[model samples]
Target: MSIPKRVAERITNRIKQFQSILDAQRARDVSEADTVTLVKDLLSEVFGYDKYAELTSEHSIRGTYCDLAVKIESKLALLIEVKAIGTELRDQHIKQAIDYAANEGCEWVVLTNAVEWRMYHVLFRKPIDKQELAQLNLLTIDTKQDECMERLYLLTREGFVKSALAEYRDRKEATSRFMLAAILLHSGPVQTALRREVRRVSEMLVDPAEIDKILRDEVIKRECIEGEQADAAARRVQRSAEKSIRRASEECEGSEANPNPSESPPVQDAH
Candidate 1:
């Protein structure tokens, strides 16, 4: 089965098996740290990350140690924090995750209890403003089982991580493209300085009006060509129909002159 389908089944089965236990745990009230341990085990067994480890509670330059950190290929890829089942995830949780990400330079962060999982992208600014780019609630792991787990698994997949990274890279690329285009179009002093700097390294100049004209001309030409083709097709059909009608009229006249007693007039062909 595909990963998504498999995750769906696993979530369903887990919910059925653990619903009562989960409810009892909620009733009994477990600590966040204990929940973190459970989550770490789940990640190791279910998600197949054997090298996962809980960070020591030592305070670092960025912040306190994160709940769980996973290192893959000598790079920290995942960071997570655990909260109690009843505790609401707040901005503080996001702040802590961001600190861990800043210190570890990880791309992803997860904050959750056993029931609710929230994943985020660690967005980095020039002067080091640590904030999350996006946050997705992966699972309640109790109520909305299938949907939650499927989404959670999607977050865990390598392709999904790569896609997020590609998006960041594309954002940078788009910004660069826009800046270059702007410098090429503008005639101000700042634009002049930018142009000289750009020309020192390369030999390309941008013409905004030329680009606009090219696009407009292409669209108009395409429409005209399509319209001409349609007109030609209509004319061909009209001629064919006229030819058919003339032939039918001649045939009818011939029949009338011959006067076949047993036969009726032939029907005209509607071409």
Candidate 2:
């Protein structure tokens, strides 16, 4: 999880306790109140939130109350929307919490029941988008799973205090965009790399026009450039395309002038 020694210890205990809670639920009826209590416990025990100072339950925002809200250093940091135990959390639950956060000008929210936790980044661009950062089941994880533990750390008090989740989300988004641009047709960086790779591994040389056609038809199906995001790579991609076309034209002319050996090879066959 890249967490300090103490936070790692806390995560181990939290995972074990959560597993025990689910195991005991084999017979006991778990109510919404029970779920809320569990959430509070996790906030205090696992995440290290001070029950009295950092956690607020039934937090009201303009008359609409969410299950919990977190405050750190007198600044509102996160809002949590709780669903009842055994309830299947869905997009509607996320939207509701996001709406509440929007009203409060909050950027982060956690939507969870007693068993599952889903963290989201509320993108308030034009239409608000709930971009999920991570989700996991408390009942299904190993105590020492590093991947899951890192995700869990995103919501921990020590993590939030240090803006860990925020940084994690930003890094993730940046990586995603880079990947999209790499495979996407309108990415200059990837086009240049792709040309080099294609020439390096193959005997056949293809032009950028053919590459674009292939990428558009066979490779990239998702729209990578949308709204403001297009501005980042559009110009570069256009320039690449243009340069590619010029090189392709020059290659075609050279090939035509010095035709292939199979077609016409300096009259060597006459010898």
What local distance difference test score does each model get? 0.55, 0.79
Off by over 4 Å in 2: 25-27, 177-179, 182-184, 223-271
lDDT of 1 at 130: 39
Which candidate's lDDT is highest?
2
lDDT of 1 by residue, 1-271 (tens): 1345555555456555555655666677888877766666556444545533423323243545667766655456677777886687786776767766777677677777766666666656654453333344323344254434445454443424445434643454334433333323332444457556656676766454554355346523334323433344335445655787899999999988888777778999999
Error of 1 at 226 (Å): 41
lDDT of 1: 0.55
lDDT of 2 by residue, 145-194 (tens): 78888888898998997888899887776666544654366656677888
lDDT for 14 in candidate 2 is 72
